[model samples]
Target: MKKLSFTTPTAQKIYNDYFNRVSRCTRTLPEDDQREIMMEVNSHIYEATLAATPQTEVDILVDALESFGAPEVVLQALVADKKVKQATRTFNPRHVIQALYLNISNGVGFVLFGVIYLLIVAFGTLIVFKLIYPQHTGLFIREGHSFAFGFISELPGGLTELLGNWFIPVVAVLMVVFYFLNTLLFRLLKRK
Candidate 1:
């Protein structure tokens, strides 16, 4: 029920535009849910811009909105979250499909994260093969326009040979970092 007042006209206008987008995105949601999300975002914008000098107010507000990500992205995340909760509470096919669609679409970084994780695992396996073979260069080949991995006799060369010994440690570090990132992403999704 309270209002947010910005001293600068430009800052206020920016907030209005961003809030309008947020409102449009939340239209399909329940009134209470819509109100809750708006309140949280509104408070965040105020907190973010309150510390900024007048000259920096618009920039700070824009950055704050950007940090929340695109309006559609936030809506997808919220929809996915709601659908998950709804699915658990009921057996509606519509809810399940909605959740599935949102999740497969723009909801979370699930597919992208999963693909990256799988690639990391594959590369990690290749590194292990290199370590075990030691004598052989292994097989990761570039065939004119493409790449393949195996004992294909006369191929370009293995990733192990191309990358040398450093590949293993690098992949190991990447695996750890990606795992951490995936965890952080889930936490953010859960908060939504």
Candidate 2:
């Protein structure tokens, strides 16, 4: 896209600095993605400047950038979205973690997803506990109603440990289910 020329040096500097900040925000993304984002921002600025009422170049540029908002704040969602797309495509844990961190503040859905992921990790760690403390690590049921999934410090008379040898498999299967459920939820969120 052709760069916009301003009547004053200050306006030009303002425009350049804005683009520089945008470039910084998008640097981690792929080149094509970066260019696409830059182009989109440039187009918005151009259109804003054109549609703006007659005014000083500095005033017009300032208004446009202000309305567009600080690049760091406004472009956060876009960067997070692109990161998520890349993460999903690559299926890399590092990328996925980055994507999640970027999107963590989006809403309750991301928060819930994060908590669910931590639970899955905790469940995975339970297998180690099962090995180290076999007696206290199984699914325990008290009064055949109250149940717990992890290590129990004390076994009361009413509490019975069930799924003795099957605890590891049960936790593993549960983790898989939770993982898929989170994936489904993440896809739904990405669509939004």
For every model shown, what is its TM-score relative to the native structure? 0.45, 0.67
User: Which candidate number has the best lDDT?
Assistant: 2
Assess candidate 1 and give its TM-score to the true structure: 0.45
lDDT of 1 by residue, 44-135 (tens): 76776676566576688888778778888766677567665664345254653454456676544656644654665676776766677643
TM-score of 2: 0.67
Worst 10 residues of 1 by lDDT: 150-159
Judged by lDDT against the true structure, how good is candidate 2? 0.89
Clash-forming residue pairs, model 2: none
User: lDDT at 19 for candidate 1?
Assistant: 85
What are the lDDT figures for the candidates, one per model?
0.63, 0.89
For candidate 1, give the lDDT of residue 64. 79
Residues 21-60 of candidate 2 have per-residue lDDT tens digits of 9999998777899999999999999999999999999999
